[model samples]
Target: MHIRQSIIDTSSLEGQRISQLRAAVEKRERGTILASKYHTAPLKIAKAFPMGDALGVIVMDVSPGLLSGDRYELQWKIGHEAHLFLTNQSFTKVHPAPDSMGGSAIRQSFELGRNAIVESMPQPVMLYRDAVLESETVVRLEAGAVWMGAEVLCPGRTLRGERFAYRSYKNRLNVYDGEELIYAQRQVIVPEQQLLSAPGCLAELTHTGVFYAFSDRIKACHAECVRSTLEAIPNRSGHPIQWGVSLTYKHGLAVMAAGTAAWLIQEALAAVWRMLREEMLGLSPISF
Candidate 1:
């Protein structure tokens, strides 16, 4: 149990500008999140970062949220017309804490403001057997700001058959609006090299999710009504679970979907908030 991770940055300032930032869980040799609920709304300047803001910062219901030669770094900075929303309360089971060496990793940094709006929905990450995880998300936007995000992965139980026996899973998402590296997504998972049966890997998918939405004034009829409800999702067993949407460079936009578990990508994110229910202001859609 080589656990040693601690990061803290609970930003809060208004009269002088540093709105709100949070990440606080000073230090814990093992993961623990029996229960946690975070809320922000009152002029919106959210804060929480030293392992706490992003909702429990990788919490495990009772034992393995992330601990196996652990090293987690989390940071968040906001100011330019700030507005932030991040969540977490369930579905973060990365078990192996007894003394597994190659199993936990996280590096997160997000800086926004210029009309800043950050929405993070965390709660769909469960990697058990031989689990090896890597996560890196870096974002810096400042040209009339706005950003939306998501990352979900599930494939251990596979209806009891156990697919992708795990052992390794890597995720990288980098977005920069200041010097133009708009968006990037990289993922790697290997189960005996078969590459999960090739063909876009995770072919016979059991669960996968990725979503990002950047903005510079997104109002094109509400993004085509959420891209026509994410292109009318339908296929399932016969292998109809890979979806896509793209629109970047200015009013940046991105949506990628893969389904099989997490209740079919949480019912396609609840039909994308019932097809953009007035652009989700009264936000309501968080389920494990």
Candidate 2:
């Protein structure tokens, strides 16, 4: 069953609807998909696409756009030996909330079996003026399982001259092995009360990308390569994009890129993913 839908009042935008999507893959081999199911509304999780041993899935938002008080849920289950990549169809634009109190929230879950691999590589989140969002992600991993995901957060609508105009954005990510929490992350961005461009903050960078990989197969060379590859991506601009990669406290690698433009950040992220896929996962780079 789909997760319990969050109670939200969307009366301001009459006829507005909430979005729920749940999809899972038991296994996939050759070109055959197995034991899969999906239920969707404004969001969709399509069938897996096979490439060598890896399977790719496209995620999309069918809504006109994210409206105020819209709640969304997406879950994916990967069984043993299953290799899945989840990519976004386009940027997710967070529109201004009508009922500021409820706002909009999204929750995503990933459940993986032993030796399984699942990747969540979505496009950037574009925050419009007065957009307020809360997002949560929970990952359940068995021994030897691997999970990777990347996210880009945009402060506001650049073309419209909305700079750090969002009301707030909060995110919490949790990873677990068995019943123990292995890693946790929390980010709260409130532009109204905080100076996002202040020293040690966003530092005049309007966009940022963060990529994470968690696995029991972490290697020293892989981490170093990931870091260097990100740093080496050339920026035609005189002021290069600020980026770095480091080994997380857990058995994973964390990469971050900050820039004034979303395109620059996205480019760096894709390059890093390409390198990691080839060197660490033994798969060819995926261009999408």
Candidate 3:
């Protein structure tokens, strides 16, 4: 069930400069790339890596870095029976916006066909002092498709002694099964406007990460096994990040962790990802 798509653009966005990239995988003989395109500037796709039948590509930012008024639009399509692993070469950084009102924006869309699987794990996005950012992500999955993704947000450059100094941050993620919306996550942070360290807020935690492993085809036994595996994670007081995993919907499970160290959250998420990949894809863990 393919839907019509075009080269995406954010022309209505401020600054007007747009970079678009698209990629797809389809069957033909051994295989075929259904769609792959790029525009003004794009997150360059590097060499393909081997990971079973999945097409692995390393994502990167080719410019000095994102600046105010920069807009990046992306599309990813995994055709029927296709597999994709999306990773990044480096952590994403939203540089400080010189003009308070001029910030960067990223909008992306993803589609997965029947029996398709997509694993999207990228590094944290560090927000610098006075930085402003807006991001939205929309994903469409076929009934039998599977999707796993993880994201981490660092309050600021801890190494530079920066913490929650950013002006404003906003992100919205929406997931859909065909045309039916399934999950949504929305966040808006303004460090200057409110005390982020109060009791219910971050409580001085500098790093936060969330990971999801979902498929409409999950079985009762499989889900129970996953639940049992995730529940046994020891809550050691010395660990940098405290993490937990819980069943979300009938077909999905989510893990979220927060800590003062990035590597701790990274290690925790990587461990959970390994368990999920082995169970979901029957594949060995890929190095994080």
Name the candidate that leads on TM-score: 2
Which candidate, 1 or 2, has the higher TM-score?
Answer: 2
Off by over 4 Å in 1: 1-69, 74-95, 99-107, 113-126, 130-143, 146-150, 157-160, 163-205, 208-210, 214-216, 220-222, 232-237, 240-258, 261-288
Q: List the candidates' TM-scores in order.
A: 0.33, 0.90, 0.88
Better of 1 and 2 by lDDT: 2
How do the residues 117-158 of candidate 1 rate in per-residue lDDT, one tens digit apiece? 566767688777767777777877887766677767887766
Which segments of model 2 are wrong by more than 4 Å? Answer: 1-17, 28-34, 99-101
* Local error of candidate 2 at residue 185 (angstroms): 0.3
Find the number of clashing residue pairs for candidate 3.
Answer: 0
Q: Model 1, 133: alpha-carbon shift in Å?
A: 8.8
**Could you tell me which 10 consecutive residues in candidate 1 have the lowest summed lDDT?**
12-21
Ranked by TM-score, the better of candidates 2 and 3 is 2
Provide the global lDDT of candidate 2 against the true structure.
0.78
Error of 3 at 102 (Å): 3.0
In model 2, residue pairs whose N, Cα or C atoms come closer than 3 Å (at least 3 residues apart or on different chains), thus clashing, are none
Distance (Å) between predicted and true CA of 102, model 1?
14
Q: Cα deviation in Å at residue 207, candidate 1?
A: 1.1
